[model samples]
Every structure is written in structure tokens, then in C-alpha cells.
Target: MNELFDSVADGLVDKSYAIIDNFLTTDEVAQILTLPHFNQHEQLFKKAGIGKNADLQINEAIRGDYILWLDKNTAPPAAMVYLNRLNELIQHLNRSLFLSMKDYEVHMTVYPVGTYYKRHLDQFKKDDHRKLSVICYLNTNWKEEEGGQLRIYTDHDSFDVLPVAGRLVCFRSDVLEHEVLPATRQRLSLTGWILDQQIM
Candidate 1:
């Protein structure tokens, strides 16, 4: 696990983003999928919105996904496992990069078929506390043809990442402009931000 953490840190230093495959084991991914929030997403999830607080708004044209925020205190054992791992990563990043990240906020997101989020940066205009953006895909047997790829735009180019189970994508929240592509099938994932300020 330290080796993996080192690789991610190195990627951030060299490039600003990293893509790691099989970050979670098959069993671990299956366990997360069994969580009540994921199984009952339709009932428990709320529509995702853009901006923060008073500026928050739900416009399907901008983004069309449902989200259920995860609370470690009440999370199931399987979910706790993932959260604990993230805590470890946070510590490693703080020590290695001096990011001063205080905590992470994550949610289970489900995008229905043919829904997408337009290109945008993860950091909000009024808030720059989000330093890192992380996503771990949970779609089993996902194919390129399925279409829900994350397109990240860089200074001179861009690239697409397929939403495959156990695949992890991490990038600088304030620096990257990215978007989700519409898919033929539902897309599921754990998505979040590593923040410099504590989230209350």
C-alpha cells in the first residue's frame, strides 16, 4: 500500500493527476456495492447540484447525477474500510506534499443513462479548499462502448478515462477542467474532494 501511495504522490509531483487500476480488490468493490445506500440509491440519493450553499442549483443540463454523502461514523463496515484507506492516503499526502489537507468529503454517485456533466473545474469560485479530487469506479464489466468516460483537459491536450471497476483517478481539484460523458447504462462511483479545511 505504501508503494501505491508513493506512486500517487509521485504522479502529483510530476503531472497533477494519476490513474491507478485495481486500487480496490474485487471483493472490496463487491462489498461496497452491497452497502444499503448503493443498493437503495433511488430512495436515498439526492440530485447533485452546482456551486455551493446559497449558489447551489440543480440544472440537469449542467449535471445529471444523484449523490448520497457518506459518513464514516455511520458507514457500514465495508464502507469504513474504504474511508480508512482514504485517511491513510491523506496522511501520506500531507507528509509527502505538505498539502495541509484536513479531511475528505465523499459521496456515492449514480448517473442515469444518457446523463452527463459539462466541463468544469472541481473547485468552486468562492471556495478553493478542495485541493484534490478523487474517484473510484464501481461499474463491473464496464466497456468503452458504454460511454461514461471522464475527460480531463490539460494545457495542450486531453485524455479520457473509462469508468471501470476498481479503477481510481486522482487529480488536482483546482487545476483540472473535466467532465463526464453520457453513457448508455447507469454509472456508479465513489467521488469526493480532499479539502484543506475541515468540513462541518
Candidate 2:
């Protein structure tokens, strides 16, 4: 586990991003999928908005996903397990990369068919506390034809990542410009940011 953390640290140092497959075990992913919010998503989840605070707005043309924020204290056992691992990774990153990440905020996201997020950066213009973006995919048996690929752009290159189950993608929140392509089927993932300020 320490070695895995080290690999993530190394990737940040080299490329400012990392894509790690099987970050969670099959059982772990299954447990997380059992979250009650997923079952009652229509009632519990809210439309994800762009911007923050006073500037926040729900523009379906830009993005069309529903999200439910997670609370560690109230999270089920499976979520706690995942959060504990994230805490460990946070500690390791602080020690190795000096990111100074004080806390993390995460939400379960569900993108209904034909919904997608337009190209954008994760960090806010006024507030830059969000240092890192992390996404853990939970869509099992996903296929290339499904079309829900994450497209990350760089200065001279661009690539797409399929939302495969148990795959973890981490990147600098302020640096990367990315977007989610519309999928023929629904897509599911746990998406969040590691922040420099404490919110937990």
C-alpha cells in the first residue's frame, strides 16, 4: 500500500497526473455501490452546479450530473473504508510531495444517459484551495462503445480514459482542462478534491 502511494506521488512529480487501475478491490467497489444514496438517488442527489457559492448555477448545457456529498461521520462502513484509505494517501502525499492538503471533499456522482460535462478546470477562479482532483470509477463491465470517457487535455497532447470499475484517476485540479463525454449508458463514480484548507 505504501508503494502504491509512492507511485502516485511519483506520477505527480513527473506528469501532474496519474491513472491507477484496480485502486479498489472488487469487494470494496461492490460495497461502495451498495450505498443507500445510490438506491434513492432521485430523492437524495441534487443537480451538480458549476462555480461556487454565489456564482453557482445549474446549467444543463454545461453539465448534467446529479451529486450527493459524502459525510465521513454518517457514511456507511464501506465508505468509511474508502475514506480511511484516502486519509492515508493524504498523509503520505504530505510527507513525500509536501502538498499541504488539509482535508478532502467527495461526492457520489451519477451521469444519466446522454449527459456530459463540458471542458473545464476543477479549481475556482477566486478560491484555489482545491489542489488535487480524484475520481474513482464504479461502472462495472464498462465498454469502449459506451462513450463515457474522460478527456484530459495538455499543452500538446490529449487522451481519453474509460470509466472502468475500480480505476482511480488523480490530477492537479488547477492545471488540467478536462471534460466528460456523453455515454450511451449511465455512468457512476466517486469524485472529489483534496483541499489545502480544512473543511472536515
Candidate 3:
């Protein structure tokens, strides 16, 4: 835990974002992916949409994926364990960086073949409580040619963050513009946000 916390903290302090490989162990990734919610509840993963609340709309051209939000009150044991880890990370960040994060939310996401998400910032006007964006990849044996990379843009340069197993990406939600490039195979990930107290 110390290793991960320190690495993430230092990365955020230095670049406003961080990409950590081996954030989860093989067993841990298996635990998350094999849960009944993911294995048996495929119907629950509704089509993802753009915008929030009243403005939300399903536009396949812009975003193409399915998502199943982890329910805080009813998440399975494996999920609860994962969420607990995130809670601990939140505590670490609040103590070390004074991020003042009050809560966290996560969802299991899947992008089928050829799916992709257009470039956009994580923060939205009406639901601006999102302070940080975190995503953990679950795909094993991923290859460069598979093509589902996270393309993050900065003022001077842009780079691709591969969706490889056990890899984690964290960034200031409002500071970066990123997009999911099209993939040749299925892509799976656990994604979430760290929110301020005002959102709770």
C-alpha cells in the first residue's frame, strides 16, 4: 500500500496525473472480474451516455461502451473489498495532499470490439464534484495492435496509455482531455472518481 500511495502521490504532485503498472495483483484482478455482477449480470450494464442528468443522451458516435455502477449499499464482497482499498487511498491522499475528498464512486465498464470514446474532460458543469479520475485495466495478454489506448493530451504533447492488466491511471478530472481509442477486441476496466465533500 505504501508503495502505491507514494508512487501515486509523487506522480500527481509532479505531473497532475499518474500511470501505475501492477497496481493490482493477478489474483486481485481475477477477483474483480470473476464476480457475479460481471459474470452473470451482463444485462445490467446499460449503454453509456454523454452528459449528466437532464442533458444526458446516448450517442453511439461519441461514446460506445456499457457500464454497471457499483452500488455502495449492495456491492458484492469482492467489490466491497476493492472499494475499501480505494477508500484507504482516499484517506492517504487527504492526509498527504489535503485533497479533502469525501467520497468515491466506481463502475465496471466494457468496450466491445471497435468501440471508442471521443476526447473529453471528466468534469461536467452540473456535476462538478468530480475531482479525480481513476481507471484500472483488467484485460490480460493485451497487445499494442489491439488498439484500445487512452490518449491523453497536454499543451505540448500527447501519449497513449495502454489498457493492460493490473495497470492503473489516475488524473485530475478537470485538467486533462482524454479519449479511448478504438479496440479490436473487448476492453474491460474499473473506473471511478474521487469527489469533494460538497458532492456527498
Candidate 4:
């Protein structure tokens, strides 16, 4: 985990993003995916929407996916374990880079076959607290031909990141505009943001 922290901090400083594969092992990914909470509370998931507060609305044309926000206070055991691990990372990053990240918000995102999200930035105009975006994919047996790639746009060029199981993609929330390409197979991932404490 320390090694990952160093790598993440260095990557963020150098390029504002990092893509790491095998952050979680195959067996660990399978274990999380097989958790009963996903099956038992499937109905809790809802169609993903765009914007926030009054501006928030389901816009299928922009993003066709479903989401279940994970509650930090009431997450299931397996999920809690993962969150704790991430919290450690939050602390590590703060110590190393003083990012001012205080908490995190996460959700389970599912893109059904043929679904996709258009290019967009993660940070909204109303909120600057979202400092970093993190996506840990859990799609096993994914193939390039299946086409559910995460296309990240940079200043000079763009890159397509395959949604392979245990792959972790971290990036600046405000700087990069990205999109999810339509997939022939269903795609699953844990997506979230690292946030700074808002002054009240």
C-alpha cells in the first residue's frame, strides 16, 4: 500500500493522473464482486443522473448507466474494508503532498451492454471539493473488442484505458474530460472522488 501511495503521489505530481493494473488481485476482485449486498440490494441502484441539486436530472443521452452510492457510515463489511484501505491512502497522500483531502464519496456504477457516457469533466462548476477521481474496475474477462474503454483526454492527445478487473485509474477531477465507450458486455466498477473539506 505504501508503494502504491508513493507511486500515486509521484504520478499525480508529474502527470496529474495514473493508471495502475492489478491494484487488487483476481481473487480479491472476485471476492468483492460476490458480496451478497450487491445481489440483495440490487433494487437500490438507480439510473445515473447529471449535474447536482436542482440541476440534477436523468439524461440518458449523456450517460447510460445505473449507480448505487455507497454510504461510508453504513457500508457492508467487505465494502467497509475496502473503504478503510482507501482512507489509509487518503492519509498517506495528505502526508506526502498535502492535498487537503478530508473524505471520499463512492458508488457502484454499472454500464449495461451498449451503454456509454459522453465526454465530461468530473468536477462541476458548483463544487470544487472534488479533487481527484478514482475508478477501480471489476470487469473480468474483458476484451479490447468489447469496447468499454475509458477514454481520457489530455492536452496533446488522448488514451483509451481498458476496464480490466482490478485496474485502478486515478486522475484530476477538474482537468481531464473523459468518456466511457459503449461496451458489448456489461461493465462494472467502483467509482468515487477524493474531496476536501468545505469551509462552512
Candidate 2 per-residue lDDT, tens place, 136-186, comes to 899999999999999999888999999999888999999999999999998
TM-score winner between candidates 1 and 4? 1
RMSD of 1: 0.9
**Location of the lowest summed lDDT over 10 successive residues in candidate 4:** 35-44
Could you tell me the lDDT of residue 34 within candidate 4? 89
Task: Give all candidates' CA lDDT scores.
Answer: 0.92, 0.92, 0.88, 0.87
Model 1, residue 40: displacement in angstroms?
A: 2.1
Candidate 1 C-alpha lDDT tens digits along 1-200:
88888888998999999888888889999998887787677899999999998999999999999999889788788878778888898999999988789999999999999999999999988999999999989999998999999999999999999999988899999999999999999999999989999888
User: For residues 33-126, what per-residue lDDT tens digits would candidate 3 score against the true structure?
Assistant: 8876555445778899999889999999999989999877798887777788788888898898977899988999999899999999999978
Candidate closer to the true structure by lDDT (higher is better), 3 or 4: 3
User: TM-scores of all models?
Assistant: 0.97, 0.97, 0.95, 0.94
- Which residue pairs clash in candidate 1? none
Residue 103 alpha-carbon offset, candidate 3, angstroms = 0.4
- Candidate 4 local lDDT, 75-115, one digit each (tens): 87767766787788789889999778988998988888899
